[model samples]
Each structure stands twice: as structure tokens, then as C-alpha cells.
Target: MTTKKPVVVELYDEIVFPDPSEAFLSRVQGHPAVNLPRLPAGVTLPPPIPVEDASKRRKGDTKDHSLTQWFTNFSEADELLQLAAARQRVQAHIAKLRRQISLIDGQQQQFKSTPEQ
Candidate 1:
């Protein structure tokens, strides 16, 4: 018989994670300089996902929403701002990677079309 261990989710200050390691906790705790942008007038935010509800989701269920889904309420303003900043940083990195890939592709095509020595 196999025994299933209970999932241990901990919330330290505002960071929530299941079974966190020391390294993970160290990296994420307390970055105080984050500035959360105020929601513009007439903007409709998506409903926030409760931490309990999120923990109950199946492994593949998480991919259906944005990173902001968990912090989409007025109550979670700081978290929402932190998530938004992270999203912006990631998008910038992705754009840089895409540009590098395009440059590499162009070089490959040019090399293929050149006359053999």
C-alpha cells in the first residue's frame, strides 16, 4: 500500500508555496522596492483565486490562466504589483531571445546560400 503525504503549503508574510526549500525561500522573501501600479479607471480585474482553491487544482489546471490570477483582487495589491513587474521582466527577456533567434536564423540562411570555397 502506498501512502500519500499531505501537501504542506506555507505562507510567509505574503509568499505562498508548497513544501518550500530554504533556497527558494531565501530568493523570494522581502524585495521591498517593488512599486505596484494603480489600476486605471474602468478597468475590470479578473476574480482572485483563493490560495486554498489554487492548492486544490490538479497539476495541469494551472496553465489556463495568467500569473496574475492569484493576485487579481483589490485586497492583494502588493502581490499583484509584484506579479505584474515579474511579467514585464519576463516579456522583455522573451523578446530579446526572439530577436537573437531571428538573427541566428538569418545568418544560417546566408551561410547556406553562399558559394562553396
Candidate 2:
């Protein structure tokens, strides 16, 4: 009786396998600037990052709302500025009327009251 040999398969042309060596593993660990947490005495380290894939992003699965960016453009910016200017003008006019009323009240009080002598 003879033992059977294992078969090898290539999944994709772009996918590159790492060299199963301590130097390669250490190089992969140091590739990123991140400092990985220390493992427990009996715990084993997680596998290295898979860079062979076209994109490592899992965020594409979520639905994106464009309204946030769209609304922030401030399409009615000019109209808003015009409204603000009108409000300021109205406030200034009200302040001027209040000052005139106070001045008139002061003059009327002075004329209405005569000297005791």
C-alpha cells in the first residue's frame, strides 16, 4: 500500500502567498505602525492581515445617505444672508425709535414741572 500525495491549487493570479518563515511573519507584524496587544500565556496570536484582496473594506455593505453632504452645501446661502441683514436693519430701527421716545419723554417731563419758587 502507498500513501496519497496532497494536491495544490491556485485560487487567483493576483493572490500572493506568504513565505512560511519566522522572518516573513515578523516582517508582516512590523509592516503596520499599530502596536498589537500582548497575548495571555496560553493564548495564541491572531493571523496576519490579508493584503492580497482587492479591497479589505467591509463598509461597502452599509447604505450611504447623500443628503448630509448635499444639505451642507447651503444652496440658499445668499437668501439666508439677505434675511439676516433685514433682521439687523429692523433691530437697529427699533433701537433708534426707543432712544427717540426716551428723549421726548425727558423733554416733556422737564416742561410740565415748574420751579417751586
For residues 1-117, write the lDDT of model 2, one tens digit per residue. Answer: 446876778785544556658887688679888477786699664455566442543433222223333334433455668899999999999999999999999999998896767
Q: What TM-score does model 2 achieve against the real structure? A: 0.34
Model 1 Cα lDDT, one tens digit per residue, 1-117 = 446877769875865576689887666564466555677799767766777877776544434454545453333455568899999999999999999999999999999999999
Highest lDDT against the true fold, candidate: 1
| Model 2 stretches with alpha carbons more than 4 Å out | 1-75
Minimal lDDT window, size 10, model 1? 68-77
- lDDT over C-alpha atoms for residue 15 of model 1: 50
Error of 2 at 113 (Å): 1.7
lDDT of 2 at 96: 100
lDDT of each: 0.72, 0.65
Which pairs of residues clash in candidate 1, taking residues 3 or more apart in a chain or in different chains?
none
